[model samples]
Target chain A: MDTNPLDNASPGHGPVVALFVTCLADLLRPSVAFNSIKLLEQTGCRVVVPLQQTCCGQPAYNSGDYESIIPLAKQLIAALEPADYVVIPSGSCAGMICHHYPQLLDGDWRDRALQVAAKTFEITSFLSDILPIKRGHRAAIKLPSVTYHDSCAGLRELGIKEQPRQLLQELCDTELSELPQTEVCCGFGGTFCAKMPEISAKMVHDKVHSAQTTGATILAGGDLGCLLNIAGRARREGVDLEVRHITELLCGDLDGPAIGEGE
Target chain B: MEQHSDTFLENASKALGNKAQADIRDLLGLFTPLLRNAAVDNFEHFEALRHHVKRVRQHSLDNLDHYLATYEQQALKNGNRVHFANSGDDLNSIVLDICQQHNAQRIAKGKSMITEETGLNDFLQRANLDVMETDLGEYIIQQAGETPSHIVGPALHKSADEVRQLFLQKHDLGERELDNTEDIVGEARQILREHFLKAQVGIIGANALVAEDGYSMLVTNEGNGDLCANLPPVLIICTSVERILPRAEDATAMLRLLVRSATGQSQTCYTSFYSGPRREQDVDGPLETHIVLLDNRRTEILASDYREMLQCIRCGACLNHCPIYNSVGGHAYGSVYMGPMGSVLTPLLSSLEESNALPNACTSCGRCAEVCPAEIPLPDLLRDLRHQETVEKITAPRWRIGLKLHTWLARNPRLYHWLTGVGIHLLHLAGRKRGSFRKLPLAGGWTSQRDFPTPQGKTFMQQYRAQRKQS
Candidate 1:
């Protein structure tokens, strides 16, 4: 690994980015949050985690309980409202706040929701779009050849197809294997995986098969929900492949066993 | 024809379990997107044309009453009789009456999804009239006593071997083996020619109806639509009222997207427009002509929040791109329409109780919306239907309660973190050895299919706070 002195200091004064560790990353995989912060801070930014932040109300929004999503939206807006920028590690959650929050919250809260949404960004896009991280300065980490799965929300809703791939190509010293139908979903639609498991299984099964066809030993994605779903299915079906968040490999923090692989 | 949409889960389960059908599903998954993408790339102005067609359809729908009246007047001037049917049963009875008045038998039919929606073939057969499906895909499914599985390619789910077996059982051809696709096509053509020549009345579906000249447009690859429309003494056109356009130019705008999106062709082999019966100057045409416009709950769809769905041109691009439709095939929808469009339209046209599971089948991937030529936001519409399901209390009470509890907890950040943190810590300890659970309470839907991975020891929020303090 090439250690180029990863520092959290900006060139002169970096923007204050409140790290919005999504509910999935908060509960299931904390490393994604750490890696995201590392990546953000390495590009010269002040990072803070608002303690009051919780779920993004995506579960309720997707389940058609719009009535219940209002307070959650309000909670997110109030907590992240003070930051210069709110950065998210997961695209699904980022997409919810950026695209769905303004639509879900109404009346007086709608303007605040939109304001919060404007500052929110998925981590990779935040580094690339807002901060303009120099490619040569990235820490060079060697990783196994991997195929990237574009989470549907991030890819379609937020136009996040190229930012992560660009980061992996410029930073990582490994082959970026391209999977067929990379834009197709892995069927991990939050509560969707639990509610419609059979269809979800078949979809993820096809996704894994496509990834394997690229001869990639690992699958990397932006969303923890998709990574968990794909990794869990791969493990269940005895497929010999590892899954990881792209940020974990990008931040050079690949010490733990791959997702769904260890005690 | 039959409302088995209530058994969507059972049908999907059965479709998933079949290995041979799985192979066909895989082929379709690979084939359709390639064709559609190639067709789209071939045209430089496809996006612009899509927008124009969307506006035209929207404009027509807005002024639907004026266009309908103009079409009625123009059609009457062109010597064609127009009739309206309020429901599927009414449409069937009107057609039955027309056939009875003509003493019609041996009806040659072109591919018509509206006919399938109304179950007209079975009704006519019950009335002792011979209804022969001339379209090859329709003919194959008809012989098998099955409904069309796809809108455009009715027998797409059937493999060549399946079709061969179906033919061998149904056809009385001599010991000659009919194994190849060419042989099957030849046999079907020969079989259908007899029906085409002897039929007294022909029935075909209109792709679009022009209010300007009272003309109905029919598009086909096999030229069967032409034969059905012109080779009989009386011609009857069946279509939904939503198929009307204000001008022939508007129909042209829609055709640009329809043909390419439906079959990946710049244009179909045969696109014919008919106004009325044969006049004294006409050499070859029907002596009598009639157009039967079916409502069939479409007016309700027009009046409801789902009015955007009426903009659909039945192109099947949404169906082709839908992942769930590819997995389960069209039969699982158990309705005349299938895929994303079907999930939205079936519930509105039929009862929500019968097709409740259709909307839940979506993963909200948004591919259907991405490829829609009509620019219908199908995922949004499906979500609206799901919202309707919740408001109407059609979803299971237990599921609703679970969602309610989740919402309440999510609204309270402290309670949400405390409860989930404890829950994850316990789950991590319980499945530490295996790193996964084969069985779990309240997650049988997930665990039944694959092992649910155990959460890492502490939640990210807990770790983040500790790390922040240490720093």
Candidate 2:
């Protein structure tokens, strides 16, 4: 087999990135990871996935187990430390690393935490804010209509409301529909979904209803936790809709079934 | 008032099912935000004013003891008796002693959450003194023998029909048509006017206690608080120690945000400051003035990570914006201070075990923090309380163990991938036909309300590794 031409490309002129594949994406949908890599490569970046990487420790941190997250935080810091920039697809995980890590870790470890935090960027924001890919670059695939759900952590913690939408509008032929109270939580607050499921269900039910009212066939969001929640409830309610990560549409890879669908 | 905080879920469920309560919540959901938006738009520098008010509150809280001491000294110099109580029980007894010393028979009260917190009305009634709640909302709730639900509009949970029924049942006057809300209000006004004149003592909550001068500021739209203070021979101000401000201007800074936040108005109809009893030149005022400052676990909160909560001006903005409060009105919180503020304060003041569910009931939507005029991080405080619960082993054992196991797996990537890969594969096979699970073993709580989505067959890492080899 011939050597890949992209491999021989020099790294100095392009941004070097470490892909922090969030646990939800890693376990639930592998296409999101591949699409993320495709989008990053299209931007002319050399991306690396550290083998030692696992989760962002948000599940533990948000559950009030600060002590339990320490070892996980240390592992994450070590895994992502060698890259020029760390990019995450999920805003919740990125927020955990960028906004919460410094607060979670203590003393001498805090400086390293801050260093990791300062270099971390959510993928859409990395594309829009850091190395903005201009609009009018259409993807090969087209979606009929899609509504974007702004996950609470992504919206409130990281201020990532417009980055994904701007990218979607720029890269796809899909009509973007806005959901009512889209800034409100879809109730997939990590373990919060399990701890207070009734309240969570009510919130997600309302979210699904709002998305349905927008008459969009596809529901898109950057956070898989929220997508899975809205998708799961829509399936249960017999509401015919597709829920996919925005990266899949942006990268022109809609091969697999939507979230909570076929194996 | 009886506290059903321990049964918060049951109370919330009941409130959610009540049609009338839901209607009231919908009205408030529309009204409060519209008024707040209008108020904000009318004030060109409202955001800057919010920052100024936050700074003023922060400075006051930082030197709370100094301000409280200054307020006490100034109040005493103005010929008002200042009393301090360490607990709610102490506060109730102090008020009782004051009433007994003056042989107070008829007492008029203007919406005081401090008194509600201390159960002062019940205690006074038990002691044979006749107490009347003079605020229109307060009077309706009193006639119905129900507790105040909302802080600003105490009887907000009651609809117009309920108010009509309450007045028809309680009022001794002959059959009068209470057909409209205006007529109901007029009836309450006619009844309360008599109490306002005949009351021997009047008790009111202070919006802020000025330190530069011993002035207790009161904000009311109905003009009842003013009448309650001036008509009675004795006036008693019930407030917490944290309500003290350094100067009158600081109080103004607070009111700028408070009125806009509480009722969506630039200012209440009556904003009066009473420094002491009747002055020599005054036409009409109370003969004796008293200020009762209650600690009620505030000093402890000030010394803790929740010190920022003391800066809250009790504007009820958090309540107005909270989704949970909109879902299941304020009475479900089972605390005098309801919604986001109550969730944090109830657990701190009351037993954590008893009020344990309050913090967990929140969705952490951050709307409360978004609307808080004092810039209090309510979600962070609630998280802190949850952490305390975990540390104290107050949370359910199954959840703790589950979290511990998840933490153990997350810390080890190789093992985590191995196990989660197998788990996801098995789930995919089990759920391939429907793509979701109607019932899950450990996630019954989630599956009971909504189906659990099945994972994709292979883990992303496994697929990535395989794809890299193929390429």
- C-alpha lDDT (0 to 100) for residue B255 of candidate 2: 93
**Each prediction's TM-score against the native?**
0.97, 0.95
Question: Candidate 2: which docking quality band?
Answer: medium
Give each model's clash number: 1, 0
State the fnat of model 1.
0.60
| Candidate 1 residue spans exceeding 4 A from truth | A1-12, A135-139, B1-3, B469-471
Candidate 2 per-residue lDDT, tens place, A177-246, comes to: 8997676678787777777676677678778988989999889999898898888898888888889998
User: Judged by lDDT against the true structure, how good is candidate 1?
Assistant: 0.86
- Reference-based lDDT, residue B35, model 1: 88
TM-score of 2: 0.95
Worst 10 residues of 1 chain B by lDDT: B460-469
lDDT of 2: 0.85
Off by over 4 Å in 2: A1-13, A135-141, B1-3
Question: Per-residue lDDT for A1-263 in model 1, tens only?
Answer: 11221132234467878888888888888888888877888778877777777788777677777777787788778878877899998888888888888887778788998888999999889877888666576457888898889998888888998898888877888899899988778878777788778888889999889988999988898998888888888888989888899888887677777788764
Per-residue lDDT tens digits for candidate 2, residues B218-298, read 999999999889999999999999998899998988899999888789889999999898889988899999999999999
